[model samples]
Target: MVSGTSRAAGNLSAEVTNLVGRRGESAEVRRLLAASRLVTLTGPGGVGKTRLAIDVARRLQSSFHDGAWLTALAQLTEPDLLVPTLMSAIDNGAYESVRVEELTALIGDRQMLLVLDNCEHLLDACAALTAEVLRSCPYIRVLTTSLEPLQIDGESLYRVPPLSVTLSGRTFGAAVAGSDAVKLFMQRARAFNPDFSTTEDEERAIVDLCRRLDGLPLAIELAAAATRAMPVKVLAERARDALTLRSAGSRTAPSRHQTLRATMDYTYQLCSGKAGKLWACMSVFRSGVDIVGLEQVCVGDDLPLEDLWSTLAELVDKSIVNLNGSRYVMLEVIRRYGQERLTELGEEDVVRSKLRSYVEDIVDELHSGWFGPGQQAVLARVLTERASVRDVLSDYLRKSADLRSGLRVAANLWPLWISSGNPAEGRHWLDALLTASTEPTQERAAALWVDARLTLMEGDLTGALRLLDECESVASALGDLVSLARATTCRGGAYLYAGRVEDAMPFLKRGVKLERNLQDDNPHRAVGMGELAFALILRGDLEGAEQVLNEAKAFCARHGEQLLLSWVLVYQGLVALLDERVGDCVALVVDALDRKRAVDDPLGITYAIEILGWASFARGDARRAAALLSANEVRAERPGTHLMRDMPMVEWHASYVGQVRERLGARAFEAAWERGRRLTGADLFDYALAAKVPAVHDAPDLPLTPREREIAELVAVGKTNKEIASTLVIAHRTVDTHVENILTKLDFKSRTQIAALFGARARPET
Candidate 1:
């Protein structure tokens, strides 16, 4: 019932590629034609489904004398509107006058191939409509590409696999003509690299390059572009580090598609100014972007909200971004390139300034407005722009003059982090801002205080101690009660981590006194009270802890700090756990988790999850505990004080359950324990502890040497290792060795971990 390609617009000849593989899919296509009117090619995005579909339709075009027609669905967004779009594409004017059944009947008997490209996004509509068309059409044929099968009736699915990477150099000549990947590569390379003439000797490396790219055509084309300035070998070498790097070699390929950069450049050029600007600024964000975040960051006072939708649409049309449901995202490579362009446009500084202001203003609002009637909507808006918020923090660490803005933002965002169980990322950014900023003020002290609290939230006593140690002098010098109070609370939290339970008491009590004296009665003060209660509970002072929780709750309610109130709820859970009221603990923790999310508190979320896991383990539900702990394990892999030292005790608690199961002779339990152990940081743990413990313990206060620190600082700002080596006048491998040493010294698992630590340690409150 699917429509055939004969209804396809545009020339079929230019679209079709001759059979270049050793075998043909003709038999498969003929079988698909016999079994189902619609055939969907489903696989990973960027696999050669489009080319394969075109070739299939071209071969079968003779059977459908009307001609093979291709109507691409790549740019379409709304699936519900597909029917009208399709009808218009085929220009079925008079057919509209007839019944829908009759209109489909008109084309049912026609023999043609209908090729639909990039139907993954609209898979549901594509499937339903294709099923209907197949039911209506008797002789028509359809071929489509998607990431997965549409699961439609009468649909025969053939997965298009990536090209084999095993082919040798001798196979290049034969392979260029015989392999679709080689042919695609040659087509792109011959146009770029004038010296791209593949000698017999060059054949092996070229094939190796293709293999390394997984033989995917798009990947090959991107790799081929790199050949312009690089030998095939060198191209492969650099590519090992950054797979997205386009070939250095130039070919006769169109400027728009010649290189990955060019393709992205073309996409950028097609966007409206605002869209381009937003897209480029979005590069500052590490993950996907949402509309709320976009509005806050991109649609400032200068850019009106009226222009936002149109700009987004333009970006969608140019394929500069993929609109996911309501949220939109740019690919990592594209985002990086866009960031470069944003800087070049001389608007980077302005954008950064605006972003910092937006964060400060919004966070201030969140602080005051959290418990208001519009709290729900406000929280949703905050959630929507959470990624962008993080991006702003990232920018501030690298460029902002006053660290106060970022520090305030970080302090305000604690609730969000707690709710999301992302203390690691939040704390990492907090640490980075504290280290990266060059300011000398209470703001820096506040940043250090926030950093300490974030680390405490993650249970990273060592990291907390490090930040607290730095803040001690600053708080004392400024006579900043909040900073001093928070620092004391943080120091207590760190002492708690090191199992110095009695030593932690005075600090927590001092923090409580300080919070009481603070004039604003903000959520941060509430947080300090909550931590005091938590410390009390940890020390088995249940009654005192309960008193502290009540105080925190009253403070939060009084200050409209609903988010901080939730952490007090989490503290209540901890109190229940201490009282052996495990079920009550579970309930309280779950409520805290929900409330944390409602207010966008990631640190609270992580704490809640950890408590939940701990309680679940106490309840003898190892399976559920393991499931919950798995998420925490993955989170721990990210750099942060909590992951490195403190909160890992929660993970260690879960690990104990798994270990217990293993000791009882359960293979599954052993496997799970091994996995959990693997998840915990070994060296980062050492580094975090080293930073906190005094030099008397010989813990290596600074994980990286001065040289490593210099390298790490550059890396935090997005410089490549090669760039770092060149800038530092060191050999590339020597730089590599230094990085490895840095990672080892700091107990970091990856560059991201180092970046997180560097971000934290780079700036100290002057």
Candidate 2:
């Protein structure tokens, strides 16, 4: 038998709709209650534990003569109120002055099931009161829901798993109809749209949507409610965006569970002090974050580093955060909820700025380490945080009129954009920033040069040359030697790509000469030197090309410039091929291909493969040459601006295509080329190198400790030593020591140089 009388019989509200899943879980809870005095339903937030507990209590109410009663503990903030709240729920006539002993005696012989919802916040109070009630009454069974077990004696814990969505050996329609996740989705979806029907395609999309949402009941329901206006396919495509969806649930439901954000907001309200601050600050990370990253980015403004781990643990106990091995993660809905709270507290801008600064530091370190044995590690780290980096750059570019940091960050990540096959995204950010920035500062000048490079990669030679002219004009007006050198080099490369080798020589020569005198070992110098070598080889100046190539190689070796080194090797390989050292050419280009692969540099690898194909053709291996050329062409079709702008390589590839076609006949060569085109980037490298790539490991020689780096970053952003000391809670002398250590470690002579390196200017005191 079942009953639903709302507050009259118990605190359990009448179900507006039947609970759609958890039949097995409900039965197990019933069985556990028969033998145990206390049965707790424990799981993460939004996993249906509360709903399942309510369902179980409703089903077994007839067996208890005093009836099943519920005392919702989520609303009670103080632990001291636990006994009074329970006494009121059991009987309104009970006096407010009744203590725990009096309440226990008052409930002495009642045969009832007490449903305690959300006991995680008041664990000690709840545990003490529960133990006293069970000992005194003996007939009252307690059913509680919490994120963690009470760990009291005689407590039976039943963890509620999410609804099952895994379907096998069934058609799409059959799977949707059978799945508990899909059934709940369809039920809620129909509430908003009665005429809704799951067609074959929509069924498949819904199944994937449920799986992507982790089959959490509330998330599925929230997504289904969105189907009132959008198709299932559209909902699936925008699931990540659905985290922001609000208030589409039944009004009768608990205010917390009525919306996804409210559900998380309830959990957030349970956290106090440092827990709340940590929760808000962690929203800056888009994915899993380790303790080291949290310490680096979240250690300021009332959240000291000493309290971070304990606060994180507190949040984990409340189920607001999850622990995945060494890393911590928040569910998407929870992250959005915290983000909303962060905005409410007016810390959104501060956190966003800190996040941007952290990413900038990461990019700077990666740039410095690009040519070392740890190149692969650097690539992996950047790829891991690529989404967050993109979000930071996009936010700064689109929302801010002051394009200082946005432009510089975009310019600094040029190699990343090329290596990660995201030049199109890079170009989008650069273009937006340039449009917003009216001042012709050196930052804008540098942005224009990067913009032109991406433009040239997309086969837009004229547009690229026009942007370069603009860059050169800005640089000349400001007399920014660094910007001028970059612009000149990019302009010369653009002309070369347009098949004007002679027209490119003067710019290349001038840029190389200017870079040679610069004090810093900038990567642009390696770029200029490499391009000059390529142009010399195109003009039949072999000795000049060899000397330039050697210079570029030495410079890259000093600066750890792996990408530029690969370019130099390509030119050397071409020179060797022309001198009839086919074996040496093959060996050099193959080694260059390996180096490019180490850095995961797609553009450099493409150029190397094309050169290797040309070398193979020179050795009379048309089949091998055709296959390699086809692989390069496949990469060119990816969703980005191509960075292979070398005119000599381009012209050679065009000529080789015809030679391979005539030599192997169209049909056979086309067949082999198609085979190569189907290979993925990793698979192509495996085939070319004939070796399995090892997993990237951690790199030693991190320049500073996480805390020291955090302090240095604060210093770079123009914080005075005293201000830094106050923010991080260190002494003024400690800040001075850290700053002095930073200068010594980075080989900088003054704080001004550190500021210049990180693109920060000191602010005047008020």
Candidate 3:
């Protein structure tokens, strides 16, 4: 199933909007992908390269073991960060930076398609990276879209043509309704303005507009957006005037690029002053932004906050901006035009500064909260604007702005950086800021501990200790108790991860003591107390551990926090297990696992499952313990095996596995573990949480008799009656009779239907 490779699976996301028209092009792309490892869909801007590539990949994703994944490079301005960005996108938000070697190895010989969108801005980097991947990964097919090709060896270039438009002596025809361009125009036009009637006259006007725009999808879309306010004929008649007004464009660029720019120019002219200004301001964002982000960054003296919504809606109506779910965005090319407008207005620096301030305020708010009920919502809100925020920070750091301010922003984003933002990127930002600003300020002290926490999460014990050392030194000198507490606890966490219980005990207690009495409702404070409890358990102090966890749980309950609350329960379960309260241990861990699942924390859920296994072993249910411990999760087959193996919680896991092995003979234990691997989805959850044995059932029999079934299989494989007769060593007449009976039994109209039913793509006539 991996095409030609050994392993991995594709992970293409579902499209938010329907693809208008690209039937012929999609088939051609599939054919190209079948033969070529690297296919570049090259065309002028606005020809729908990105959309077509994604559509074709979606159709073909299942054929590759590792499915097609798209990496949108429009936001990445730094070439050095390209590899990490690629890794993040392809890995679907893996929280670490992967080396080029590691990336290729992880994808080694796996069949997948990598769709690189908008490579025009970073052609050299895209080319180099593409070359390296194709060299190291023989089975991965690369489909890239750009204004031009990546220009590498063995590259197959598919010059994507504009959607077809029927022409009759430079005039409209009745057949024009069937044209791809006309269909696209009608669809976009009707979508924006439901009241706009699509009569035969309207179709004629749409056909004329499509033909005049040279059948370019983007130009057609822009023209169609104006149909709500005026007739399609009006927009069609005005098209030539708009196209010629902006006759100036890059000579090297294609004519379609000029046409698109001219359309943008006309779209801009149609806007009121306030609308135009806000549109330009909105360009400062690297990607989409929510309403709050738009108001904070775009609205000011020239554009009042109250009037911002109307102006944004105006642009959206004109098709210059698109409202995608909660965020407003301009297409990459549209964003570029807006950026030009921003620069022309001489407000680029001021606008970028506003974005930086907005990001700073957001991160500060996130830092102040994020351990309570609103935690997930706040994190998601900021993440929605991550691209814009990251661009602002990158712009600030590049301009050599206040290094300490940047460091503070990075420090405040610990939740994002460590838990969500791919801590590797956070480390990179912090490392850059830290190297630039060596002064032992309170900001730097805070950044040091946050970076240490990230390193601790990464299991980099020595690196964490080194950062914590600097953090302690700076905080001690500055007399910042909060920073000191963070650093001390983070250091203890590192030692605890390494199982250095005695080495961790003193620092854990001091850290908890320093943070426990803080008046503010900080989430980190409760988590710190919970860490001390974990250290106490590892140190053989059950009562002390229980007392600490009870306090941690109460603190979290007061804050309405479930994540840290779940951890408190896990710790309590450990204490109960050590106290020989087997029922309490199972109840506590199962309850914790339920909470962990609610928060979507894979590691936490795995920890709860492991603790539950310990309870099973204590009860002398060796068979139940083996079943509980089996790799039975359907890859969820062994629900937490991979994470469990690499986690620092391996301290007790190996010892327990040895105990279970000693109790059940190795062979019988292996059989139970294999059974565990067979469990998936709801069944796995049911058995894991309640010890309900999974039920087994057999599939229903097929309707066809043996010989008729054989004939049906042949038809599904695209064999004709002649081939079926030859293969089955039967008379041609008999094969035909069998085929007819098979069709009647399935109530099918065509052989293609049978092929589809069997999950085989019906091969087309040559």
Candidate 4:
């Protein structure tokens, strides 16, 4: 990872997609390197020079004895850090101090290839270093990427050309697809929309679009991603009105490449005056917005509402914004630049006020449908736009002087915060709101109980009690029964979490009665009923727990409430387990798991898995019990959930494990434990629910594949991806993929694990 001060040279970030074109350029670069010690690849920005160089290095790496290293200089600004950066990549994980004067000693006759990328800005420094390096290191070769030639002795320059986009005398056939530019455009368009395909007429439109973009890879990719919004012919028609292809090599290269802010300065210099203002105002939307959202926020004295269409068209012409379905999206780089421009224009507060109103309207619509048949739709919509809601709360609401409106918004959004398995996050927002708005109003009262409920769910018994005490008093003062009932239920749940079952009964009973009298249709009534059933189960009232759970479950079934229904079944499963109906208990938990998984509630899934583990232990299947419990621990790592922390099941783990160990013996029990830890994805759930076991290999096959082992051996000897690919006669991408799989199969995080295990087994020649 590149930090604030320096760049770490590792494998080039492996491209997730295939290399679209440039095969001929890759081969040509290799031939040039065989004749000259120093070669430079020059091209316009976004023309694919860096990718071509990486491909060439990967093919030629095996010939060199030392290694091939790509030192990206795109982010390096200060010329003084050049030597430190090269030394780090050359020495690779070593701290041996070597001065610039000792360049010959550092090289020492080793045959290595060095690829210095993005050298146009530091032309003088690059030339000075290249001259000194070629003179000192007799066996080393250097490759560089720049906007112009380095203009030095012993150097050959190769100017990379754009991808071919001509029809080649064919109207539309395989000959047309043979053009590198057409192939790249089709591949990138399908990557954005897998269903994208074209008729002959549409193919002509695509070829026209590529020709208009000058076959530049970056420009083509930006246009390709917009296929989801409109047809190719439609976009091509729009492109003619916006784009005017200016050939490269006419103007001098800009100084910045790596940082978007610096690149934005150059891009903004090219934009019209009206487009810049519209770009700045549009920055308030983190997620993409429709035309209506743009008009709602960006319409002001400086930017009229009607001007949005034309100014936005100019930006699209510049390939800054992409349209996806109903939304106009800016790439993250351009959006960050737009934010800086928004700050410069001094309209952040004015723009955010419009956003605040938009979110307020959205939340009000979301809350109104929470108890009816549209609840599922409401929850789905909440999940979809969760990012915008969070942005408004963070940017505008938190910094406001009066937090009453903020509190109202936050309190109403508790369903999303909980259904998304983010109760801890909900508590964070509510805690801030409660502290700021200390007045005892209806909004504060509701926010207090909401905070208390989330706090109790997170196992903070003391904190939940503190919030609920204030809530009870304020709700009583304001005569708000809804808030009072919610506080009472949370107080009971807090006591239950503390393992004081008898102390929880009276409060839970009163909460249920108050909720029922108020209205049985509210979601809070179901919440109270679920807690009251859990209290009944803990007190040995099995029959009573079943009756209460059935009622809540029926309510959930009618309203399509999967999240709360999952919880109701969890307690019902516990009641069945104590009733000695073991099969029923497992079936119930499995059903709950399906519902929890649907809502993406991982914590709820973990709890349900634990209940099945307990069911297995009670039936005397100690081996199955051990496996299920171990799998739960593995699943628990993501949600940061622990059976010992929130539930009264702490003693069960120790007691069940001892019995399991005695039955299976120490070694066999350890084998089972390791097997369970290795389970993940669908396999973990399958094993817990007694689904079919996934067939897997053992030994060398289980730990690493043959290709992975070969790569690991090369990696152990300090070879980077380019070196490994060259030595193994494979592509650099292939080597990176094998290394990633090796690490994942062995459960290792870094290549250091490869070095630790296979370092001694490296070949003598390497």
Candidate 5:
């Protein structure tokens, strides 16, 4: 029944390249289409929205009796020919004489999916035709690929996100290989040179290229094509220039898509004057910018300050700019294109200078906000604009100008580097600024302390000690009490982490006394107190540790310091564990885990998981303990600097493993441990929290229809027929029929038996 004009049975084009990633998005799109008559895939141009829409329609070909029809609207120069073009695409013949009403009647009541591609240029025409078709044919569904929504009644819009290049902390190797962006690049690379292989460096270079391209499929493909003539490193280095090169795309693609610049030019030409000007000016921001920033830098000349928001709205509607919540971002390729336009208009220098000033102001605000109640919000903002800040620092330092500004910005971001698990990137910026500036100012002293903290996180105790010595010397020369306190605290933390507890205590106490004497509500005093307690605990001074922790906890609560509060909870949990109060330890550590998860602190979460695992082992839940340890191991192995290497983790790990092995025996413990390791972090948390394993039965020996199998699997998950119907976007009667057929095929009398059988079969054998 599925028939249309194409090599495939449907009107979908024969895909020359494989669709990579987007498995979740594809399923969600299918579900949306099943429930709504009109579903529009909307994103910026060249984001692969058209290809995704076609792929979704092709998958649902069997569901539509007549077929999925594709009408490409990109080539239509006038709105008058819209209906005629669609009719020809669907009918496989000339429909020059057919009127729009007659064409709507021709599609009447036929169950089908009509795909309207590239509808941004023909919005009015596409919307008019779509309204007519949907009103006349109730059973017909329309799927659209557009830069903007058709905005008709009952339309579902899904914004297509770019391919993921990073997961958790992984960015290269096997992890990078799994990303859809990298997969697309490799596939296209092999297409040109079949014998092509990559070394580790080349693979990393490709990953960097994909990331720089912002995972745009068209850009990735073009970059991949260049690999035929150039090495990956060379291609990555020249990517900004390569976007202007043409004729790399498939001949079958539209002329607009044959080159990156052409694709952008098409979109750019469609934008109105104000929108286009705004886009050009906004390009100066290398990362996302808020409305305030846009107003400050992107207003003047052709783009009046009063027209900013409205023009931005139009640009967003046209998909020329992406507005994510309060911040706006453009795809890297689009930004580059806009930058080129700005240069053409001779405003690049003005825009860039404005951008630099705005960023400098932001960094100053962040520095002032670092120790206040708004610290978390400031940190989040810095994380969002980290790339822009890095670029500005590099430019300032490279030119040997604004050295003090660069030094202050680097120094101010110490808490972020230490807590956000991005110490390596932070260290890179800090090193550049420190090496570029020779003056021993307060800014340099603070930057040196930040550098020492980051170095300590990387397990370089010797290097950290050296950095701290320099920091102390600079702080003494500058007579900066705050920098001196921070330096001394970091020194103590480094010694403690290196297992020199007695040596750590003196520095820790000295830092705490200095901070308290300054009469400041600084969080470093809290940090110093917590570290001193840990050193005391490791030295068997339990009473001293408890008193110090109590003081630290009260300080953290008064200051609204969640990160510091979480560490305090960890120390309390350790004290409870030392006291053999397993239940108390578990309760405290779980609360700590919640705090860490709220702040997205992975290192804190890892440490809490270690403590929870120990408490579980003490409570005789060996399997749960093993699972928690495995989860910690997985988290610790993420691509970043290590943060958990203290005495408690080391002692607890060895003891927990030894005790669990003795209790469960080597073979059974290994099996359980491996099972835990395979579970993702969220899955592991669920496993640890679940009361008991569900019962299961073996798989039935009868073959079943795909629909029946699908229904059976849903039934096994304990969903009723009505729930399954809603989830699958089908009629309740259809689910009942499928379930009936499933039971009949398996000779089961009850859904309970079906659930048990499917559950056992679906779960992997342990």
Candidate 6:
């Protein structure tokens, strides 16, 4: 019997969905496949290059005896290793360094299809390999995907166009329903709102969406994801803010996503020295930036602040920047690339220094508004400049100096973090500040208080207690009542997590008294109260918890603290669940979930989803619960220390064991569970709750014999049936007989899936 690793490539077709507007492209692809050895699909980023290539490759897979091989190049940073990676895929994990001539000699007479996916970044490597393979392998075919053509000899280039949007006679929703763009939209939209199917009334807005996105596939996919909750009209309106969405941007995709950056670079290069300086300086803001910040931060008397508007307009026209009503923003990817180029041109450090000056000026402005009518605007500005704030903090930390500015910024961001349910991230930044301190300083103690509060949410009682103790001594030494109150509240919460209810009560009461005595009206103090309430809830102090939560809610409302309000709601939901008020629990949990999503708190969002999953399971909707758990699993896997905070979710993964086993096959499911358990050990709860997914176990030793597996491998690697027969010294008919048996055994209706199964695996992301 063949082990899984040594078996022939599975024979199956690459799945493709040809939407309404894809009819013309489908025919065009068929025509191109007739005699093309290398049919390269070129288009701009988001212009449907990948989708188009997949669609065509799927249709043509059966013609070639050897199935198609797909190699994705997106995450590959090192180009020199590209050819070797391709060879490994085709040669069944073998890394033999055969010359190009020798490699081609093995497949000289093979009628095979090679599909190179996402080749834009490694275009040069792709071109050279394609040329070598095609020249040497007589019957081998290659299909490549890129943002632009290789422009190599004998290469047939097919430029993929965006979805057609000429549905004037049809209403927008109707138009989209009949188009490939709308199908893709519906697929992603269903993820957000499964009930959201295409409706006639929503057609005009859908068409507008596709049109504004220039019918580009990637842009459409991203925009479609937004439609889960947004109204079609709102989606269309928001599209205007993204300049690349405009149809006039470019018809041709320039070999990947860099086309937009290239445009921005060209525009920046042509700017007046002052305009160029202004552009680089504007990179400081994290969120959508505005003219006022630019003027206040970037403009001087020589490039007077009043004259900034014209430069902004010029930049917008040239697509160097985007305008969103009063707010202007640059695409995150484009902005990063532009920053790199600007640095290479010797303008980065100078621009960054000026950007710092701008950030400081803005923070000063924020300070005035913190007590004024524009507090809302002030908070928005702070959130927008969060990245810049971090930069400032890093600068202060590096100099080993205690700057009131950095401290003040950290304190101010506390309310923002609490509102956004991003206390975890907030605590991380706070800890960074504390770590930078050379001594056991009072300021570090203040930061510890913040960190301690965050630890409570993740049920980390020990860490919270230790940090709270550290905060107490420091705050006492500094004689700061506010800091003392924060430390006191954190200690109380830690006690509550540790089940020391009697000890928790006194500390919480003291914290409340301190806040009232000191006239501390800060929303952070309210967050402390909320934390205390959550602690009370945990200890079964229902009436007291209710009263405290109400007070905290009112306090948050008064301060317009959305993040805090959401947490209060989450606590209320948890209380309702504990009290067996399932309906109330669902309502409150759903509300908090919505709020978390609105604030973009992945950590909070995952937590809410986890609770929702449990709630769904309680409601006997295991399927729905499994789906929620699965989504949370994806979010929890985000790289770096972010994975550490998700330990609770890691424990909950066992709850989905049955569901995972049912969906991924018993063997595969069991393997993953064993791996996870080995990694996490007994601290994680143990349970197997999955239904086993069905597979054809009978094929273990049936149909295709060892000889068939060998022939299938060569056929998949671009060897013709005749070449394979000759290599194995078998009759050509015997090779054909083996191929038929192999296909039957694998249950693959087409060779593309066979090729794809051999190619698809868990590759490490660069």
TM-score of each model, in listed order: 0.54, 0.71, 0.57, 0.58, 0.68, 0.45
Worst 10 residues of 4 by lDDT: 691-700
Writing each residue's lDDT as its tens digit, candidate 3 over 17-65 gives: 5887788899998999888899988765577888899998888787787
Q: Give the C-alpha lDDT of model 4.
A: 0.74
By summed lDDT, which 10 consecutive residues of candidate 3 come out lowest? 691-700
Deviation in Å, model 3, residue 109 alpha carbon: 67
lDDT of every predicted structure (CA atoms):
0.64, 0.77, 0.73, 0.74, 0.80, 0.61
Per-residue alpha-carbon lDDT of candidate 1 for residues 1-766, written as tens digits (9 for 90 to 100): 3344344442365742343452455467657766777787754444567777777776666667556677677667777567665665555342222344543765667656677776656767888777777777766677887655677777787766666555444645665455566777777777665556766656666766676665656567677776776787787656543335654534533443445565456555545677777778776655566676677767865468998888776665444566678777765556667788889877777776766776677777765665544565656656767766877777766655556677778877754555555567777777677667746578778778766766676565666777788888888888777678778877876776666768877887787677667666455567567766766776678999999788777766665656667778888987897699886886677666656655555444556666665675565544334534554656555533253355336545546556446533465455444544443333322222222111211223575577876887787677888999899988999989988997777655567546534443333211
Put down candidate 5 lDDT per residue, 704-730, tens digits, no spaces: 877787888899889999999999999
| RMSD values, in order shown | 18.6, 17.4, 24.5, 21.7, 10.9, 24.2
Question: In candidate 2, what residue range of length 10 has the lowest lDDT sum?
Answer: 690-699
- Give the C-alpha miss distance for residue 416 in model 6, angstroms: 4.9
Which of 1 and 6 is the better model by lDDT? 1
Superposed by TM-score, candidate 1 places the C-alpha of residue 36 at a distance from the truth, in angstroms, of: 18
Highest-scoring model, lDDT: 5
TM-score of 5: 0.68
Top-TM-score candidate index:
2
Runs with alpha carbons beyond 4 Å of true place in candidate 6: 1-273, 283-288, 314-354, 357-386, 401-404, 415-428, 439-443, 455-463, 498-503, 577-582, 600-766
For residue 209, give model 1's deviation from the true position in Å.
12
* lDDT of residue 389 for candidate 4: 76
492-524 per-residue lDDT for model 4 (tens digits): 877876778788888998988888888656788
Candidate 3 lDDT at 493 equals: 77
Q: Which ranges in model 3 have alpha carbons more than 4 Å from their true place?
A: 1-263, 616-648, 661-687, 690-766
lDDT of 3 at 325: 90
Give one clash count per candidate, in the order shown: 63, 0, 13, 0, 0, 21
Over 4 Å off in model 5, which ranges? Answer: 1-242, 248-258, 270-273, 300-302, 360-375, 620-644, 647-652, 659-676, 686-766
